[model samples]
Target: MRLERVKEILLQQVEKGKLFHAYILEGKNCDHLAGVFANAITPYPEDIVYVEPDGLSVKDKAVMELQNRLSMKPLEGSKTVAIIKEADTLTVWAQNRLLKTLEEPLGDSVIILLSKNIENLLSTIVSRCIVFTVDEETEITDLEKEAKLQARDIGEMLLRKEKFFTITKKLAPVLSDRDRAYAFLDALQEWYHKLIMVSMGIYEDDSLESHLLTKERLFSAIDHIEEARRELNRNFNVSYSIKNMLLKLL
Candidate 1:
């Protein structure tokens, strides 16, 4: 479902007081959407339990910790929300341990699992939760349009094996503007995401770029774009990160 549609459904559920015990929010930008959903439940920060993996995987210990927390009543509100970020990274044992909670959640508690991809999760666990897949496309601003065009152009150049100097020159001006640089990175991620959807026959834009690229190549592009975004978020040098990402893409 599109993000907007998911929001609408969630709102209706909230109004009717018919919220499920568990929900699996699956898609890119899920972390952002999860925040929105969490706020909709309650404004009290103390009522929300945000869980993140200590490392690559959410260990069994973390799941046990969550289980212990949920055993107690809500600290501030009638409902206690537990948000597990990057839930796909949960280790097999952790997921298995979480299964019991999903199967029989504590009083007035909601467990929200956010994942970029849900396939990593067990089918039984997935079956126990409400699943929402985000695929929303909003109206783009002029800046975003320009950024997307630049991303497409750079992608084409990279695919054609353009010279390093040429690619760097095209990207330099974009990196110079901080706002546009972030937009460019976001557009780049979206561009590759669209390609992946097209490759999977889930999207039907039928553009030359989508037709020319394979799923593997699209995944590679998306991964590089995500890395660049993470670097920029961490205050890495903008130009350096973009250049590094472009080189990795090549």
Candidate 2:
């Protein structure tokens, strides 16, 4: 969902006095969503508590800190909001610990899970929340879907034999400004993961683009993709990051 839509939804929920158990925000632009949540709760003190998943390794400590924030008697509002960005990046131990809180969140508190891939999340974690997908643009036609399928097929064919750079060059323009910058990165990450799976012999299907390639080349390409992703995260020039990724994959 778009930031505006999330704001609208949260406002409506606040008005109705119905707090959500948890909210899973899945998208490429989650930073935008996090900002929107902060903005939505800014006017209403005691309505939001933002958490960072930085170097903290103790999930209980993190949860305790959040609970303490919520424990503060509502200064002016009827609800409390907590946003966890890059939730999927939480360590397995941390994610497991978080499951306890998700199972029984504090009363009148809403927890938001900002993640790109909900598939990696624990089923229990997913079950206790309302899921929101960000990019519900105009419905796709069958032809468009077919073309994407074809593109994916072709892209995979190129990934084989260590031909990452060529596919990057040919397909990069098919993306939009936002997609090229962020969403494409997420897609590339997913692709690299599939390549790892192939290298490990854990994969049998080649329908996904990465699987069409051989394992050795896939793993080699993944290293470069990961490096590019890191550079983007480090606030390196985005245009440079994009170009670097294209050069590596193409």
Task: Return the TM-score for candidate 2, rounded to 2 decimals.
Answer: 0.48
Model 2 alpha-carbon miss at residue 154, Å:
32
The best candidate by TM-score is 1
In model 2, where do residues sit more than 4 Å from their true spots?
A: 1-10, 37-42, 45-47, 55-60, 136-250
Candidate models: Cα lDDT each: 0.77, 0.60
Q: Give the alpha carbon lDDT tens digit for every residue of 1-250 in model 2.
A: 3456656665655455444567778887777666665556445745667677667432546766776776676566756777887777766776777778777677766788888877556655755565565664567555445444534554465455346555545655533243354555545544555445344443334655335555445545555555655676676776677666555555
Error of 1 at 153 (Å): 42
**Candidate 1 pairs with clashing backbones:** none
TM-score of each candidate structure, all chains considered together = 0.55, 0.48
- Residue-level error in angstroms, candidate 1, position 103: 1.2
Give each prediction's root-mean-square deviation over alpha carbons. Answer: 11.1, 12.6
Best by lDDT: 1
Please give the distance, in angstroms, between residue 139's alpha carbon in candidate 2 and its true position after superposition: 5.7
**Cα displacement (Å) at residue 158, model 2:** 41
Off by over 4 Å in 1: 136-250
